[model samples]
Target: MHSDVIKISDKDIKKPKGKVFVVYFSSISNNTHRFMDKLDVSDARIPYELNQELIVDKEYVLITPTYAGGGGDTKGAVPAQVIKFLNNENNRHLCRGVIASGNTNFGDTFAIAGPIISKKLNVPLLYQFELLGTQNDVESIRKILEDFWGEK
Candidate 1:
């Protein structure tokens, strides 16, 4: 095990410093986790549990997978545990970023999870990106994260 940390000069710190959190439901494609890991933010990829403290945090990027007949959507269901976690009142005022994973075969299968996350996060939707790949999706996701976070 190892610790990874990078320190920037004071000049760099002046540009809107904020924490990042990822509310992920399922990482079947691992694209979300890959992006979050690249972000280097203290995050939680709970395909199971979420709590009030999660909402209180300011910088959050929630990623949820779309599903229908049992696949990316977690057995064709919207993991109620995550929904309950979002329903918390403390989660309001969250800064937004989103990444959705789904099959492009469906019209909007890969991009609809953001609204639900936005409502709960109470954020203005900073950016949303989608990824659709069978096994190579993770590599493509890294580029998207770089484009998203590297932007001014």
Candidate 2:
């Protein structure tokens, strides 16, 4: 099936209104949280210790970090908190896309969570970046979100 999720590229230069709603899960290291802070979009952070399920009322992009097991195993790559958040049917339905973060040192598993979630949820993997991302990553993602949501 054709997907509406926008794929970001270098050519997308629209100005972002910072209106896109982002939902993310950041581990204790806060790599994902730190990355989200750099972007101007509205966001909610999924607590590492989730006591209640989160339900997103509107469409959003999910940003999460990879947590691959030892020995370069892909298992447990997607954070448990992220899995819990996505367990809700409403939240799953509203997930427009995903952006994953990881360390390049992990090699083959770098940002693997993005692809896994994208396939499971049938949404696009909008982007992936190393820990905290760069200034270019922030600017590009903001612009892409604006263009995708037609808030440019």
Top-lDDT structure, candidate number:
2
- What is the C-alpha lDDT profile of model 1 across 57-97, one tens digit per residue? 55455566655332334233244555665666554334345
Q: How far off is residue 90 in model 1, in Å?
A: 1.2
Model 1 reaches what TM-score against the true structure?
0.51
lDDT of 2 at 17: 33
Error of 1 at 58 (Å): 3.8
What is the per-residue lDDT of model 2 for residues 50-117, given as tens digits with 9 covering 90 to 100?
78567778788888998874355789999899999998888887887788888888877888888888
Report residue 32 deviation for candidate 2 (angstroms).
1.2
Candidate 1 stretches greater than 4 Å from native: 1-17, 27-31, 34-40, 47-56, 69-78, 119-152
Judged by lDDT against the true structure, how good is candidate 2?
A: 0.78
